[model samples]
Target: MRAVIQRTFETALFVDGEEISRIPSGLTVFLAVCRGDTEVQADYFARKVARLRVFRDENDKMNRSILDAGGEILLVSQFSLAGTLGKGSGNRPDFGHAELPERARELYERVRDKLREEGLTVKTGVFGAHMYIEQKQDGPLSFIFEC
Candidate 1:
């Protein structure tokens, strides 16, 4: 499982020109599930994201987790994150490492639910849908985690 986590001042998800989910002062997660990924990885990643200390503290230092900062999360499924480029003529991006849709959806939900269980407000984009995401990234801060 892979997650691209971005700290944001605000974020929203749009599908077919209509807003579906939104958050304020939080993190936006673009998650990808690789072949053979399991719920155990999902659970671990969810916990790690919640405890990641990317938020600034009273001392203006990056010392607060999303939980400590009282932030929300906007989770979006992004299979393309697993895309790979090969050598020579096969250099085009390939998604062979991505999990099938059914399994990927299941794992995505597990991560979303787990984060909610951790007492953080969580919003989500529609799984498998084409979406337009709008976000004002805080400090242009971002991180990538793989599990």
Candidate 2:
């Protein structure tokens, strides 16, 4: 499992030109499930993302986790995150490393539920839909984590 976390002043998800979910000030996470990934990895990434201290503290230092900063999370399923360029061939991307759609959706829900269980406000985009995401990034802070 992998997650691309971005600190955002605001983030929203839209599908078919209609807004679905949005967060005021928090993190927007693009989550991916790799082939052979399991629920254990899902849980681990959820906990890690929630506890990552990327927000600023009193002295303007990056010292607060999303939990500590009282922020929400907008989780979006992104299978393309697992895409890889050709190893020794033409410049073509391969998505062979991504988990199948059904299985990936299960893991994605696991991560979303885990974050909710941790008491963080969690919003999610449609699992397999064409989504349009809008975000006002905060400090352009971003991190990628794999488990």
Please write out the lDDT profile of model 2 over residues 1-147, one tens digit for every residue.
Answer: 877999999998999999999999999999989999998888888888889989999999999999999989999999889988867636878888999999999999999999999999999999989999989999898888888
lDDT of each: 0.94, 0.92
What does the lDDT read for residue 9 in candidate 1?
98
TM-score on alpha carbons, each prediction: 0.97, 0.97
Off by over 4 Å in 2: none
- The weakest ten consecutive residues by lDDT in model 2 span 84-93
- Output the lDDT of residue 28, model 1: 96
Residue 113 of model 1: what lDDT? 95
Query: Largest lDDT belongs to which candidate?
Result: 1
Model 2 global lDDT (CA atoms, 0 to 1) = 0.92
How many Å off is the CA of 40 in candidate 2?
A: 1.0
* Residue 19 lDDT, candidate 1, scale 0-100: 100
